[model samples]
Target: MQQLFKNYINTFRGLSKEIWWLALITLINRAGTMVIPFLSLYLKEDLHFTVSHVGWVMSAFGLGSVAGSWLGGKLTDMFGFYKIMIWSLLATGFLFIALQFINTFESICIGIFIVMMVADAFRPAMFVALNAYSKPENKIRSLTLIRLAINLGFSAGPAIGGLIITGLGYAGLFWVDGLTCIIATLVMINVLHPKKAKVLDEIKNEYPISAYKDGTFLIFLLAMALFGIVFLQYFSTITIYYKDIHSLSELQIGLILGLNGLLIFIFEMPLIKWLENTTYTKLKLMLFGVVLTGLSLLVLNLTSWSGILIAGMILMTIGEMIAFPFSNAFAVERAQKGNQGEYMALYSISFSIAHIFGHNAGLQMTYKFGFDITWYLVALVAFVCAIILYFLNKKLKTITN
Candidate 1:
């Protein structure tokens, strides 16, 4: 036991101080993301809102994300990462705390908009910093460590949130999340704040935020948009599906959902090293992941048992872990030096755009067609995404090469 523990630390010894700090921040941020798992529960049980109302509120977060990505990129180009990140952290923390008092959807909408914009702005800055700090060979490793930290927090957050919700209810989850954000804000402020000299270099002479003009970068963004639209079902409708359709127990649901993050934590390092050499084909994994995710849902329709559904979810999780790290790495590598935030922001924008239509459409399908039909519809979208990705990957490869 002692030998294994020492070896584990030795393996990760290659990680830089900055990457370690980023990893720590990743943990904090993911703990914040845990609130989403219980968001619907909170809205319906605590806020006394309808399912549709919850949808609208969640959609508002997506809108904020859209604004955040564009504005964050612009600000990173103008003001620098440290300032944007520090402000973003404090703003999100305050928003989480403020949710303690909001009464209506309209108020919640405005609050979430501010929270997401600030939180998302910091997200791309962290990505930019990670990319800048990596030493060529360690890019994927750095990404995987970041992913692992996040998944760890994600795994813990939901289980803890679920328990808190069960015991003290939604407001309890909010207080805990608010506290997590406060600490995360402080951590980012102290540990990861970038130097002022570096800020001047990025901001001086006023570089155009025309990061959208980079053709390969644009193609990468679109590919990921399609990928995200396909991937979100794992979180959105699927959570509801497990409860309403499969009649899964809360503990079982936690286990099934938690498996994804656990596997990612265990497998990410080895997988990153193996995939280190892959380039434009990075998108191919995403294509396959979507297919696998769609296929899992398809298989779920054929099974009424909780065990089978759990198995299918495990498969979908594997696909996600495989796909996302590659997609993120591709976006970072394609950007010019000093413009990583803009590039990552551009990459993130694809997902934000996909969400605008994906969830609304998904809710409609779930209501009108039943869980099985929703699965089929999600499958079709994933299939289309896979085909488009394959075609675009070839074009991107030719252009990039």
Candidate 2:
């Protein structure tokens, strides 16, 4: 037992202090991620929006994310990750607070779009910062460490957010979300001083090419976007499904969502560590993970029993744990071939595109057809994407060999 505990601890051993600080900042920021998880609920219940209106608003959120990711990537490449990270966080803090004041349908859509634009800009810049702070060998583990912080915060956010909604209402969610961004910004400024950090020289590829010109990478991004679409349903229509179909309370829903994060927190790092030592290719692992994710959605259709909800969540969480970090590492590896900022931006933007379409499609399908149909459709998408990724992996290997 003691040896097992030590082995788990050793997985985190080689990461740099700056990476730890970055993880801490991510923890602080993500811990207050209360609003998005509950945004559909808030719109439907508090604002009394129709299902269609909710879909439109969520789509707007995705549109903003795409714009933000593009702008952030460009800016980070031009200006440097440190400046972009600081400004994005600071701006996002203010925007979240401002979002509370806008109540109408059009205004709220505009509000969410603006807020996400500023917020998601942080993503690519943070990735660049990870590149700067981490040693070459430690990049994947550093990414995993940051993801662990994110999951930990996610676990806490929903449970606390549910309580906050119960006590202080949805308005409280905005305030908490806003304040945490500000606090995270302050911590970043204080701890991760730009002057003290070590920025590694960009990896020089033998035949460097623009990320735009990379055909294989673009295909990979498409698969990522599809994965994002399937994964993001957890934040959107699935919440509504739990509420309307299963008749779960807000707290129960929050706890269930929190369970996804808690499981990732407990298992993901050690799992990644174990996988790192194995002979399995990252692409092969990702394919397996994607298959698991599809199964997770399919599991939901198997039974109406609430016990199945836990079963589905477990499958989805495991899939996420396996897929996301490796996918991130793959993107980073690709980014090193040319412009890191541009490549990473496109990677983030793929998910942004997913956000734009995924939520609306899920909601509209649920409204028109039903949750079961929506699950089947999304599961099909996941399975199809997995097949594409499999082919892409083979092509990549051929090129390398």
Candidate 3:
């Protein structure tokens, strides 16, 4: 037990102070993530929007994300990540507040699009910042640490968000969300001064390639986008499923969703650390994670029992833990061989594209055919992507040899 505890604790050693501050900033920012998880519910229950309307609004959010990510990445390369992060946070904070006032379907769609455009720009900039703050050797663990903070915040956010909705209504969620973004920006400004933070020496490639021209990396991104589509459903349509199908309360739903974050908080670091020491390739682990994620969806169809919900959540969380950090590390590694900003931007864009399709597709399928069919379809997509990734891995090895 003592040795086991030591191994777990050792996972956190050797990270720079800037990485810690970045993690703290992420935690503060994500803790206020009350709005997105409950956005579908808010639109449906509060504004009386139809399911299809909710899908369109969410797609608008995704479209905005793609634009934001691309812009942020481009700007980060030009102006640096510090300015981009600050501006993105401040703009998004104000937009969240503004979004609360727009009630009409068309107006709300535009509002959400604008809000997400400003907000998601933070993602690529944050990745660039991660590259700057962390040592090359510590990159994956650093990513995992940041992810831990995010999950920790997510664990708290939904439960607290549910309570806020209960007491202060959906309006309160926006206020809190806006305020948190502002506060996180303040923390970033105060602590993470650009001059003080140690920027790592860049690893130069013999022949730097444009992210756009890299055929192998592009295939990897396509697989990632598909995996993202499967993963993101837990945040969007799945919430409605818990409520409409299982008749779970808002608080219950929030707690259940929060469980994903909580489990990642406890288990992910140790798991990543352990996986790092294994002979298995990162691609293989990613493929295994994809398989688990697909099975998580398939498990939903096997029974209507509420117990299955926990089982499915556990499967998905484990899959997420295994897949996301490694995928992030892979993107960062690829970015180092080219224009870091552009490479990371394209990586963020892939997931943004997933957001574009995942929520609307899941919601539409559930609305028309039923939840069972949606699950089957998404699960099948994930498995197919896993196969693609498997082949992509083999192709990468052939090139290396």
Q: What would the TM-scores of all predictions be?
A: 0.90, 0.98, 0.98
List model 2 lDDT by residue over 171-262, tens digit each. 99999999999999999999988889877534656765789999988999999999999999999998899999999988999999999989
RMSD per candidate (Å) reads 3.1, 1.2, 1.2
Looking at model 2, residue 366 earns an lDDT score of 94
Which stretches of candidate 2 lie above 4 Å from their native place?
Answer: 200-208
Q: Write candidate 1's Cα lDDT for 158-205 as tens digits.
A: 777667766876677677777787888798778765652222112222
Distance from true location, Cα of 126 in model 3, Å: 0.9
Worst 10 residues of 2 by lDDT: 199-208
After superposing candidate 1 on the true structure, give the runs of residues whose Cα lies further than 4 Å from its correct spot.
Answer: 1-13, 193-209, 249-251, 277-280
lDDT value, residue 13 of candidate 3: 100
User: How does candidate 3 score on lDDT?
Assistant: 0.92
Mind giving the per-residue lDDT tens digits that candidate 3 earns over 112-134?
A: 98998999889999998998888
Q: Residue 66 in model 3: shift from native, Å?
A: 0.2
The stretch of ten residues in a row with the least summed lDDT in candidate 1 is 196-205
lDDT on C-alpha atoms for all candidate structures: 0.72, 0.92, 0.92
Q: Select the stronger candidate by TM-score from 1 and 2.
A: 2
Better of 1 and 3 by TM-score: 3
